[model samples]
Target: MKMDLKSKLLHAVLGAFFAAASPVFAQETPNVVFILADNVGFGDMGPYGGGELRGMPTPITDQLAREGLTLTQFLVEPSCTPSRAALMTGQYSIRNGLSLFIIPGTPNTLPKTAFTMGQLFKDAGYSTAIYGKWHLGIDAQSLPSAHGFDTFYGIPPNTSWDSAATVPGVMLSHSAGDVPEKDLIDKGPWIMEQKAGGELKKVKPFTLEERAKIDVDLTQKSVAFIKEQAAAKKPFFLYLPFSMGHSPNLPSKDFAGKSRIGEYGDKIMEGDHHVGQVFDALKEAGVDDNTIVVFASDNGPTGLEFSNWSALGAPDMGSSGPFRGRLGAGTEGSIRTFAFIRWPGHVKPNTDSYAMFSIMDFLPTFAAILGKELPKDRPIDGVDQTKVLTGESEAGARETLLSFIGADLVAARWKQWRIYFKDEVRTGSGHLQLGGADTGFIDRAYPSVYNIEMDPHEDVNVGGNFIWAMEPALKAVMEYEATLKDHPNPKPANVTNFGGN
Candidate 1:
């Protein structure tokens, strides 16, 4: 399915012709390109808070926000796998068995039973592909192609961390483009997957220096896929979950020293460059006006009052803007992520929406755009926001959102009030100020609460006065628990179905 240079150009021309004729034959369904950044902070971009402080050049992301609506209250799960699972299935990860961390070479696949957003769009005749991180599962049944994507590539589990995959004497300088075919190998711990949920077809015994440029390779592949699909006269659903700003923050040689804050900032700048490339590709394909491009993070930043890594100490981890806490703490900073949506001619440009929108809402919202009803067999935690997205309405409400550290519901945001059922306190683990939290410290007597409308940072605690506010939230959780009891997640563990292959 990989296209060569000439083939890509030919397909691009054909696709353009078909697109031009599309207006006469049928009303075109919008193509969707969802970009999810790994461990990006709430204030990492120019539109967010990092623009003024951090010297990372994020003009593309900022321009995208200016050309569309920037959502201030968009939320997601505090971790990678859980956020992705909720995003794809429109259900909480706790019910889906992906609430915990996903280890490599382990049984951490999402269930085949759960109908995903990819399947929904693919079933509707959209050409679907996912290039980049697919952390849902490493197994065949749990891979991206199995979950409704027609083509899938890139790292299955995750990239190698500095603590694990460092090597010496590797070449460090190269153009941010495709590597030579002769350098490809099929043996290495960090093998880049090629087939759709298939075995490792390509790998290389590359040094850590070479591996650092994976984000660039992913971007090239993604743009090529977009062009190929466009040539085929088919609309596409491209889910590009970038592996940047994660641990072992490695920027490509082309982007080295591009940022003022060093390696992590360089990676962010490089990531924004890739975003610009994608946007440019859309425009080149003549589908810029019709394409629905959504940019957001899987979770919050990697630093702050939570788990601290080397990148954080480089003082390079993104800021959480005005929020507090970091990833995996069930705080506002952990769940509140940057969200921007752009659709030309439909959604108003340069507008801001404070509507509480969850990443889970995407599936139902997309379904609404297709004028199709969601399947009635199961419960969906997402609400349709067609009006909210199209600029027809300024007001929207998710009303309640549950934040979890693992299987435990640590915090619940009910409208303006957020109640913390469990206290997450950071403890020094011999790493000085760099520490991890001692989770599950439930305070039954005086659980801390915050009015999010007044104090978005969660600094002031008014648990006693807002104790009554938890009444309706607790009832809602009770009702949700009842539904889960009825339609329990079948694979509340990994999707371990390997048929002797």
Candidate 2:
């Protein structure tokens, strides 16, 4: 059947429209480098508030804040594994079935069916590499290679420098069985083979003094990877999750005593130094302008051994700024964190945005950058905030965020109000009062309300007289919880009970 003149013209017009739009889409692809810092606090950086620790003002991190957009209301899960999982999948930890840190040698792991950011980039013809901690899962099936990373050069699980089998005070991995330390050393490819029971088995022949040198060597390798990828003209996605400032608080000898606040401060400075190396690598490769660099923490400070309360004559080393509570608690202090992004010529410089964002949004945001669409069947709790990052929009992409404290969903942030399903815990070293006793758990039935816009510190709880006013926000939270129940539980494993027997 021959088309009439009107029909033929219509087809020609449609063809031209698609042709014009195709090039615009092709030219929009940009390289992404997501830098995740472990256990970093909101006010830990020099740009934020660390002048007391570093004299004469260290300006490397401060420069990023000056030249990029700072996310004032960014948040993450309370711990490393859940936050990492959320960032990688663009879904909540509960949705992905990885709500807790994956126990070594357990059946629980990030399921192979779920898609990750690395996989998304790899599918789009981008080279992806992760060079740091992979604490989400340690099983063979959950390895970085299987999760869409083209190459991985970091610890497969949470192994540290203190393990006896490794070089004195250097991170190491051992084979996955009861192999002798001597046998592990004999078996080559030293870093990949780790003992099964989370022990570092074979020590490299490096002397005790040489352990600090290993960190430098890792930094060099990471820089080399960036250089190589740039030379090949490949747009790369590098996930650098550093282990510094987490535990054992070890920095190189040169950096030790560099801060007035002791080891904790020294480690913070060292982490900034390593971040500078990554920036230098990008600049050296001539890809700094085109690459989008995002720096954020996995969660709040651990403060177990290096509590600021004890070290600096303060209550905690890492401050959550004006937010209340600390790591592991449901307060803003635990979830709210530092997030900064640099994309030269794209993002506005030295600007602070109050747009509510989260680690859960990274995957979707990256997908938006690459012009990829998420699967419709997979319900993503995160929205593409590329507009907010690029200064095209000012409004927060999310109206509400669900927060999980331990095993239960305890609170939700909606607009200016944060509605807690449980009793709000007191901030800083105070015993949580539940049932007239000192119970550690933040009670959930009382439903405290805080106007975050006015009182970020959460000093006053207005839930008493405003129950009627808070009904809408509280109802929204319940509806969200119900939606999760209707869907298949992403993680089906039993919640491990670690209470004293």
Candidate models: Cα lDDT each:
0.75, 0.69
Q: For model 2, where is the 10-residue window of minimal lDDT?
A: 430-439
Off by over 4 Å in 2: 1-28, 51-57, 158-215, 304-316, 424-443, 491-501
What are the per-residue Cα lDDT tens digits for candidate 1 across 427-483?
665545431223334556655788877887888898777689887677767878789
Q: Which parts of model 1 have CA positions greater than 4 angstroms off? A: 1-26, 158-187, 194-200, 205-207, 304-313, 429-440, 490-501
- The digit string of per-residue lDDT tens for model 2 on 58-99 reads 467788899999888888887677788889888878776666
Report clash pairs, candidate 1.
15-231, 185-203
